[model samples]
Target: MTRKILHVDMDAFYASVEQRDNPDYKGRPVIVGGPPDSRGVVCAASYEARKFGVRSAMPCSQAARLCPSGIFVTPRFEAYRKVSSRIREIFLEYTDLVEMLSLDEAFLDVTENKKNIPYASQVAKEIREKIFEETRLTASAGVSINKFLAKVATDQNKPDGMTIVRPDQVEKFIESLDVGVFPGIGKVTLKKMHALGIRNGKDLKDKSLEMLDQSFGKSGRWFYAVCRGLDDRPVEPYRERKSLGAESTFPKDLENSEEILRELADIAEELERRLLKKPFPGKTITLKVKFSDFTQKTRSLTEDYTYIDKNELYRIGSKLLGEFLLGSGKSVFPIRLLGLSLSHPESSSKITTVNTEEEDDLFPSLF
Candidate 1:
């Protein structure tokens, strides 16, 4: 059976919301994040800011250097969550099979929707119009027979646009798209493919399955399947988070231990803020670091203690780094990225005893 999926993505969501609420921010370079002087990173950037080469996850200091006059605003999650709920409500009115990808994006499986909208393109249009009318916000919608194509079509025309990939046109559409446009293909993957002389979907489609497998292993199989417009991923309404974490790539690598600690501390603070909302009372804290050479390493510690403070996280993370330095016998040169993650500890009930022994076994001291 053919499935009709509609992907709706808001343009520059966080920055856009800030602009919408404040009239003065409209049509201006607005960035959502911490102050530039504090070594913060840009969480989101408005389209106006994009003109100055500003982008999300780019260091706030670099963004300021790019656009000195850009306005900076801390994220307002509560406000954005309220807006997200309103949008989701609008989506549910058309289809019960709604899968939210993030706070500002979702996919609607309208094949079995109440409206019985025979044409997926019509459903996408109506949804966009209604969203604009009710929320005074512009949305881009992609209509396709499946999720992957629908997502691609939605991005074809951005900032209040819509695109449709009909059943008959799926093959041509997939063939014409750039390989980098496919989900899960990051900068590193793209670079590797470029070195292999693969530039676009057509080039990727030309490669043999064995060649892909030899290069990317299991992910190669997924790439081959998607190149033919085939994806079996379903749109489930329930939200299940597989992982929650935060990471930052610095504009330039830093070598000083002091600077690295300061940066890690900032990232830990952001993680705590996000975790507090979910009451992420997990016992495992993992530190992920990527060196200037692009070598990545992870060190996890499961504690008898639960923590959500920057100071505690920094202390543990610093210890892990120390251990790595001692083992590798190589000093950290320039730091590229730092990440922190937490996982739920095994437990039976609220009154259960803490498994101190199990915790020790889970995290062995590197020293």
Candidate 2:
């Protein structure tokens, strides 16, 4: 069976919407995030801002430093959600096999499309055109045989562009890619691969399956498969929210115990707000912290009761934080970031294994 997948990603969705609404924002650096002085990060940055090294998830203060004249716009999530819903409607006109990775990006199976377009490339182009015509925003699409290649292709030529990777091109394409381009290969994993002298796909493929398994443990098999252009994951129209989380990076490293708890209290409120939209009713509460030096750690607690109260979330999360910090309930080191999330549904506590769908570390969730 012919498998045709397309990954579509909006170009700076939040920033673009801001620019599109305001004429003066065009051709200027627009960073859609919190105030520069605030302890919030950039949610999305325009391509103009990106040229100055500004990017999503970067601290707003740093983004300001990078793009001195960057226009910082507070996120209008409701507006973005409306645009995202419109885009989803556009995708459904082509195929129902649409898997939304986030509000601004999705994976689409256009192998059997409503338009009956024989060439996947043409379908991708049509989708991009339709998105622009309707939303007044541009999109990028990558067309290939599987979700992996399709997602990667979407990033190749961005900002209203489309790329097609044919069957014959798949092998060469996979072999020529940098190891960092593969999904799940985060900065830590990429650094480890570099230390092991596996810089590119060719180098990674040279190692035997046994060697890879030894090196990467469970993820080794995934690496062993994708390096040779092999991925069979299908596009599902719906996906259950594995976890719902909200996190923030402080403008200054927090050292005071009171201050830390206050921040945790705020995060719990935000998480509570997000969860209320689509209640998870989870039994596990996890706390994530990033120290001043960028070292990260997580502590979780599974209680008998379900997660419903913000006060309880803060109570349990603070307890976990206290345990992690240790010694008189005070921190020896400064804390720069704090995150709270709920997972492990009441029915089951099993939450370890992560596929692509489960591995969004960037405040990434619909729930």
Candidate 3:
């Protein structure tokens, strides 16, 4: 069946919430993260900040350099979560097939909506309006025949805008679509594709499956299909979150063992903060490392206890990194990325609701 899909994305959600709550922050570049002098990374950046080259996951120091007058605010996830719940309720009025990707975005299969809306774009428009009316926040939406198209369309006209990708326009649309704009293609891959003279969907489609396989390995088939506007991935409403993690790719490759360990320590620390906030309580702590050559290695250690301790996690992660560095037999130093994750959720720990302030107001800034 040609399903009707909608990708609804909140506009600079956390930063937007901060702006909404504090009118003074409204038109300014609001960045949600630690102070500028700290070694913390930016969690979110408003569109205003984007103009100054500030972006999420960028170091606060760099963001400060980019946008000197940017207002930095600590994240209030609980506040954002409340707003998200209100928006989700508005969505359920139209359809039950809602798949949330995060607190700020979701995929909605409105092929057979509860409201029985015939046109997907109308459903998208109504949903966006309802979200704004209820939460006092703007959301952008994309309506299309499939999930991939719908998702890409969501970014076309962003920050309270809607874009529809009709089935008839899919071919022409895909022809000029930039490979870099595709979700899964990272900076390195985009550079490689550019080197191969494959800049857009048409260029990508020109390659043989064998060529893609030789270049991207098993991911070649996926690239081949998506470049042709073909994606059969289904949006499952009850998709379980298997893990929670934090990772950072360095602007330049890190070669020193101390530098790699230092980055891993920071990643571990960030993971702990996220764990306390998300409360997944998984027993497994995993360390994932990527080399300068783009090869990846992962080491996992499962603890008997359900909850993770910050010290214990960093210890294990550092040890894991040390083991990889010694065992890989690479005399020279370059590690491209460092990641840490908590997985294999605790059997007894179902996600608890945050009703009262004492219950889940975990952020110090909120207090």
Candidate 4:
């Protein structure tokens, strides 16, 4: 049976939410994330801001320079989370086979939908409409026979658009697509593909599987299949989360032990709040540090049991920090970023205890 997939992406999610809540922000450029003067990056840029070439993951400083009149807003995760929950609720009304890619996007397999919708495109339309009717925010959707094509269709016409690729049209759609537009094809990989004269799906499809594997390894196999519109991956609703963590990048690097410890205390406090909200019982604590030169190191210690207290998290984080200092001979100091995570959960049974939080446990930043 052919699987009918729909990918729904909230347009400029953070910035859009800010605009929806603030009447003054309407029709104006809004940037959400860190302050422009800080070492923060753009989490989301409004359509108005995107006209100035501001984009998510770009430095906030650069975003400010690109659109000097843009309004910079700190991320209010709680508000975004509420909106995300509502969006997920709308998705569930259509199909239980919903795979949330992030707080702002999800993939739904509506082949056997709760609504018993005949066409996936009509389901996409209704979902988008219901989302806007409930939240006053817009979403773009892509409907196709598989996840890859659906995701690609979502981006073809973004920020309040819908694109559908029928089974018969999938071949032409894949053949004409630029390789860079495919997921996981980053700049470095694009350059490699360019070196091999693989500019689009047509070029990619010309390569033999053996040649692709020899060039790009496992991802080569993925490209080979996706180029032919043969993605067989299902929309998994119950994906396992491997870790839960948070990190902060400072405006300036910290040099002394006192400053480092102080920063870790703040991070531990943040992690504690997250754990309390979505209690994941894990036996491991990992500390990650990145230097001003971009070099990074991670230290992890897994205990026999899970950490349930805030003080314990701080203690373990401090211990890891000390170990990193001693092990690196203080060479990794003047750190620009610090992060902490808890992993190796006690069991899948423990996951059921986590309430209100999404399934994915990587970090807060989806992009």
The candidate that wins on TM-score is 3
TM-score of each: 0.74, 0.73, 0.75, 0.70
- Better candidate by TM-score, 1 or 4: 1
- Candidate 4 has what TM-score? 0.70
lDDT per residue as tens, model 4, 139-242: 99999999999999999999899999999999899999998888656444576688889999999999999888656644678888889999988999998657
Displacement of residue 272 (Cα, Å) in model 1 is 14
lDDT of 4: 0.79
How many backbone clashes can be found in candidate 1? 0
Full-model lDDT for every candidate:
0.74, 0.78, 0.76, 0.79
- For model 3 the local lDDT of residue 230 reads 88
Task: List, residue by residue over 259-300, the lDDT tens digit for candidate 1.
Answer: 677777766665654544334557777777666666666766
* Model 3: lDDT to the true structure: 0.76
Candidate 2, 335: how far from true, in Å? Answer: 22
Stretch of 10 with least lDDT, candidate 2 = 350-359
* Model 4: lDDT of residue 279: 48
In terms of lDDT, model 1 sits at 0.74
Ranking by lDDT: 4, 2, 3, 1
